[model samples]
Target: MEGSNEELNPNAMTAEQTAALFSKLRRRRVSVAEVEADIEAGAPTNDAGRLNLLTYTAWMLKEAGRGE
Candidate 1:
């Protein structure tokens, strides 16, 4: 849900900023499936898609947070 805002300029963000951003997202208590469903589609298993898949899932997990 957090990433539903403006498109991210991954190039413009530092690792710390990204992590902190995700951390904030986690506190929002969104669901992994919610984030997944918001996206047009899931990532493929191809090598090129692996990182993207990981990033998407990580984002979802972040938004979902702990103790869920």
Candidate 2:
């Protein structure tokens, strides 16, 4: 199953690219509080909104070492 999953996305971003993007965000020190503020201020209002919220939370937690 794991092999199948990997095969399904053979062109995915490399670990280095992922690390660099996150590192850039960390250097910027973007706060989860700011993400929350944007959500509360009506950033979006559809599936995209939910996805943005999820992505923001995931990034914050990942930086904090609370994400896998």
TM-score for each of the candidates: 0.26, 0.32
Model 2 spans > 4 angstroms off: 1-26, 45-49, 53-68
Which lDDT tens digits does candidate 2 get at residues 1-68?
A: 22233322222333333334445656864444555454565433345333233444455556568342
- Model 1 residue runs over 4 Å out of place are 1-11, 28-68
- CA displacement after TM-score superposition, residue 24 of candidate 2 (Å): 2.4
lDDT of each model, Cα atoms only?
0.45, 0.42
lDDT of 2: 0.42
Residues 1-68, candidate 1: write the lDDT tens digits: 25455555543432333444556756864444443343525422234222243565565576568544
- The worst-scoring run of ten residues by lDDT in candidate 2 lies at 1-10
